[model samples]
Target: MQETLTRLTFPLSTTSAPCSEEEFVARFNQRPGKEARMGYDCPLCRNKEFVLRVENGFHRPYACRCVTIRQNLTRLRNRGLLELYERCTFENYHVTEEWQRGARDCALSFQKSPLDGWFFISGPSGCGKTHLCTAIASQLILSGHDVQIHRWVEWAAQAKAAVTDSGAYAALVQPLKDCEVLYLDDFLKVQHGTRPTAADIRLAFEVLDTRYNTPDKPVLLSSELSLRQIAALDEALAGRIAERSRNHAVQIGSAPGRNYRFK
Candidate 1:
């Protein structure tokens, strides 16, 4: 492995410059193994020594490429993919000491098992529920999981539009059904005539039903609605969600001097 990596170099002069002893010495000196191996003996490449076989092929008599490639792949999987996480910051997301500890614990637990569980974060506006939920989603994505975020009103509008168009409905449903993590922010923000429309209730139920039925894979939800409020929207859907969800909830207190908004 050492010899192969050391021997690897960029061609300096292309075919214009013929190999010379001085050039060879200079290039060899620049190589990684030259200085160390010149004085020490390599047991693996010594006379009568046995060579190991790798998945690619038998190791070279003095150098192995397989080990280098394996190391590179392992490093890439760990560090390279971590860079893909999408981070968002908001001025109102004040992480209290207690919440910070909880967040750390939550992150560690997710890193370990990464189970498909539901999370409901309910709080008045400007309480940082959305910020924290998105932070969690970003962390999960960095760990090589798929995550999707949607505003409650926007999602309702889209789903409503989809009801009249089969293709549109499928497009919306597939991601909601398949994503590793799905975040629904500002739940219950969609307006209806005095109560949630039958279609709205049905759409919500369909999503919850799919997740509830799939035991191996579950969905996560972040909503501004309290349990009681949610139950009021659709009792049957609420019951189904309660039955399958892991029952994680976060409630942030409204900050002082900040007005709360309800829809």
Candidate 2:
């Protein structure tokens, strides 16, 4: 895909023709048929203006940056995150404790270089874990990467409902493995002192193992359980999650004013 984009963009980069922003717009405002088909409002160029230029005596097309943003927005909307799109942003995430501030900074860093690895955020309910997770997801989306956010229990319920039909189950959970970035919000909400059932382990293993095996696909998790608690759920499943998320693990609770829900 990068190769394809490079091929398409090479011609535009080769020559210096547009003297100014106005000239660029005046000369190349023609939108591509493909862009029109996508139904975006000139996001690729970062501006509504697109360019079709005769550079080096060859006609070349360029997409607007707005198109890229719109594409990212579409990915979020497709994955049921569109509602959270506006509410979850770095600027909106409140930080009342030192740890919360640190966590927010870490999320910002992830936004800058998300390809580093996955993130595992553990905290009590209302500690703003979901807010932080969604903020990171939102930033990544704006950066033009595909992202999917799902509450773990809800996803599991949906997956389990398809148990009678093998094809339905596969269709339901396959995206958890395939998306470029996945945010498993409220992960593993099992009752305390009761170990996760075998069925739970099986489902968790399938999703976690697939994402862990694919190094490029980073998974973000926000859970109430600590890493130790998660390991207790199922050693094998938690091991898979831990191995990939080791460096990026963040614990944010027990500090003064850690919970942001009231704030």
Candidate 3:
């Protein structure tokens, strides 16, 4: 019975294991397409298709390395971790010739070494802080690193919720903690026309403290706040970020006749 069962489950081939002739007949009857179609023969072992039991079920297709490679490429692209430049619209980014050069240089630097240190882009509103940061993120992702982009306000809200609702909070926190590169878009001291509240200050401090002082991963902050203004928002947090970052700060400003890309 065991011998018959084995033959019934697997197709017979020259390279295939031996089984009772009755089992082969039973399997041929049970599997509608087994007989009419070419019998299972290992592609690697022979030039024909073979039956392989994959996780889901029996596949009457020979294993091809190309399938695995294609699947991996599809997964990487779908994850939005590749094709970073395509994700952000670059032609829409407006900046002066000099600032554009600087932005390109920063992007190249990040592409080469995404784990270097924190990057803080700060300046007045409409100066393309977020655009440049997004560009950097896109470049890093194309280079095969995991990247996360978030708005400052959105992150603040999640952190606040995490304080009270641990589960919901962990959903946000775990990603931030695990991501290879984190981009905080429009980071600043105010939200909804109000100055940074006590809670806001605490939340910012906790995130920066954990990321900068603990495992010491790189973070990117795009903000309209100037360096001095940032320092004023939370002196300790600003000080720590400044001390830990490589470039200290990046100031993006507008040149006359240039349209702002961040608006």
Candidate 4:
């Protein structure tokens, strides 16, 4: 079968190394048909996105490494997070302090085992909270999970606008309640650093409670307010967040060197 496949495949090279994405595109004048094919550029799996391997005296289809790349790109693009995903990778995340390193570890843990539980990081601006959350979103995308990057301030505004229209409200907010992964950045964050209003607290409970009841679907959050601060405003919402993120929560203080903005 190996010999048969080798003989049938066209325009594939002898080298085992795969072509870079740029090189692959350069090899073809136009994108292949809607369906994948054994095109000229891809030597690994010949562009079928999966390869057949001998197993139990039969051949089984196994996903190629390249499939992961394509999936990540597609999902990121669809969710409008491609640029951020490319930029805020775990590899490029800077860690200058011990607490920062711990925060990164928490994000990595959640990214690796998303079904495990929720992850939270609360810190001042320029503390790399969004970067870590973006890192998690990228990894979740790479691992074939749909991630919703919820900029909480903007999201809340949209939800608030649609509140009077039941259909529009559900259209705007229902996805967050049931998304595979929801990364809420700046949860309950007020512009002047004031506490959230009763409405903000209620909106948070409406969305968060759904995820709270469904433990299998995990969440990621970054906020300027720490869990304790959130508890002071509304203990029920904060308690659920604290319990879910118990294992993977890290709060970076405003102590000297904690805020990278000064540097």
Cα lDDT of all candidates, in order? Answer: 0.53, 0.71, 0.59, 0.75
Cα RMSD to the true fold for all candidates: 14.0, 5.9, 12.0, 8.8
lDDT of 3 by residue, 1-263 (tens): 34543453533343242655545433433343222211122222232123233222232334333333333335446655345445554555654576665665565565466677787777666566666777766556434455666677867876776788888877877777666677777875465678877888777776677787556487998777765677887788878777766553566665564322211
Candidate 1 lDDT over 58-79, as tens digits, reads 2223333323323332433454
Q: How many backbone clashes does candidate 2 have?
A: 14
- Candidate 4 segments whose C-alpha is farther than 4 A from its true place: 1-80, 257-263
Q: Write the per-residue lDDT of candidate 2 for residues 222-244, one digit (tens) a residue.
A: 98887777777678877776777
Where's the lowest-lDDT run of ten residues in candidate 2?
31-40
- Consecutive 10-residue window with the lowest summed lDDT within model 1: 47-56
Q: By the TM-score metric, which is better: model 3 or model 4? A: 4
Quote the positional error of residue 15 for candidate 1 in Å.
28
Count the clashes in each prediction.
Answer: 1, 14, 0, 0
| Model 4 Cα lDDT, one tens digit per residue, 105-175 | 77887788888889888888888999999888877765657667778989898999889999999998898
Judged by whole-model lDDT over C-alpha atoms, candidate 2 comes out at 0.71
Where does model 3 exceed 4 Å of error? 1-95, 253-263
Better of 1 and 3 by TM-score: 3
TM-score of each: 0.57, 0.74, 0.60, 0.72
Candidate 4: worst-modelled 10 consecutive residues by lDDT? 31-40
Question: For this target, which candidate reaches the highest TM-score against the unseen true structure?
Answer: 2
The best-first sequence of candidates by TM-score reads 2, 4, 3, 1
